[model samples]
Target: MTTVTTNKSEPGTTTSSGADLHLQNISKRFVDFTAVDDLTLTVPSGTFFALLGPSGCGKTTTLRMIAGLEQPTSGSISIGGQDVTKLPSFQRQVNTVFQSYALFPHMSVLDNVAFGLKRKRVKDTLQRAKAALAMVELEHMASRKPTQLSGGQQQRVALARALVNRPAVLLLDEPLGALDMKLRRQMQVELKSIQTEVGLTFIHVTHDQEEAMTMADTVAVMNKGKIEQMGAPRDLYELPKTAFVANFLGKSNLMYGTVLEDLGDAVAVDASGHRLVMPKNRAVAHSGAAVVGVRPEKMRVMTLEAEYSPSANMLTGTVLDASFTGVSTEYLVDVPGIGTLATFSQNMGQAPAQRGETVRMTWEPEFSFGLDGNEKATEGKDAL
Candidate 1:
């Protein structure tokens, strides 16, 4: 995994407090089922880390474990250099924003924000709540009940409630999942902004790839209760560690083949009758069965009649269908030896190719990647 330094901090520089959160071999089981299996990770102070995976992949369970809401069957959790694994939820210096917003339907926004402080018998609770609401730009709505507010406003209230506590770390579980696409995007930006302003460590759990890419300084892609890969958004997207990471994070066109030769920096793969050259990352080696994964945007369309260089990774195929999506065009191409492949082209005002038109598809050698050993041995089909 690569370490990324955001504008909020210098490279290799720790947060002001130097507080590090660690989850050491954390595991949780319910009777016969293991919700989280030996999960381990370290979230640097002030870093926006995302726990991303599909449902039942143990992301939420891991979050609950960190928040002290659920006790781990084994392992330990430490926050700010203190072992808080056995501590109750309130005893730990952490706050959570649930998906439901969990606002008091009857209490006004100001009262709801102040509830946590009041329960703790904190002095000047109203003043603290007003300041929190002001930070969220909702001070004007302090007197309004949750029922009188919109979805976005209610979400802000929830954020204010959590932020008012001034926890060292914040846990958000699909906080924007309740909003529509447009609203979700808006909230994503707002959440990032707030996190930057507060400079608190954020551990967000979500299955949305776009959401993770847009907001997180680092993304940990999980599968089957394990971290498949973890890195910066661009690194994970451009250079995936495994086939599961590649297909899960974005759409990909996979071609099965056997490695014909390894050239240190590049490897040759025999795709049925075609020989395709691909980049040889550390995980990929020579002379073995492998799969070539390419993103749709990396492929370019060419007519069968057009001459192509023998060095290029090209395949003859017929366009089975095409879909125009304003920004890009999607095509299903059927080749004799490769079966069907999905290709996409940016809409640059060019005329769309009609169905039944024979074309040659090509992509750069760097744009293609050979699968690692783990992916080659897995019998399950690719996710995309």
Candidate 2:
């Protein structure tokens, strides 16, 4: 059963054309498992918010709840200050573009985009659908059937179909998951541009770290049915509060250490008997044990005899292996007691380090981040 309710704005909150989505204390349980646990968030109007996590991390469940596909076991959902907790999916001012384009194979691209508007008895359905197609740069493909279009084009059709309704909030459930790597990257750019042009609240659920970081203004990293961290992509990438965020978002080399001293603007840590310093503001731990982390790309790798800044944190290691990954060379270095660490050095026509060759790794203290001592160093190392 579906119920229609008038839009109601919350006191002291102004309603905008692009609705601000609020998920308060939301929880969802399925028989033996909890999918979403007490998740609370507020996506600002017209913002591109990404729920990023690996599969089974509750990101999809959360999106399903927001789109009215699943009713929360507890808590409330509101958009533009109007409570839609009990409303059916169709009754809410929301539209979704799923991984599976879900276009009508028998219908032309234009008709597929216009289907929803035609059903709603919306005026000038053709004109509105054409406008939506143009938004995705797919207006010229309107006469073709979905079977005749490329995966990328079909994905755009799905986007146009959902967008034509002019929903207050647009839900993108891995909308680019089906496209190839190159096409996915292209679509990511197009999607962000479309979102900017329309200025609508876009709640994108994606497992691709680069996709989330590239497109979202804000990304909430979820784990085990809860959000581990939420912030801007750069913030989350550079200063992750947890080991999971560090390893899952990008390649991070973590070294377990004990806090030796607290210096107002810096913290000293003893790792494998070697002293290291990290910016105090970046340290999640100032006392006891700490996990010092630096992204692979942040560390510079050179021969052991190379001159390095005296203030930089340095480690001597033997090269375990090296891989040329097009733009950069990735080196796996074995630093005795500290275990293996990875470093990425740009390919500037320099000789690649050889296996078993002694090397030195150094990075500025400011680039180092700290995580709580107890966080498992391998927490999200292999996530997805």
Q: After superposition, how far is residue 329 of candidate 2 from its true place, in Å?
A: 0.9
Over all chains combined, what TM-score does candidate 2 have?
Answer: 0.95
The model with the greatest lDDT is 2
Q: Which candidate number maximizes TM-score?
A: 2
Candidate 1 residue lDDT tens string, 178-197: 99899899999999888878
Q: What is the lDDT for 306 in model 2?
A: 84
Global lDDT of model 1: 0.83
Identify the runs in model 1 with alpha carbons over 4 angstroms from their true place. 1-18, 307-310, 373-384
In model 2, the clashing pairs are: none
- For every model shown, the clashing-pair count is 0, 0
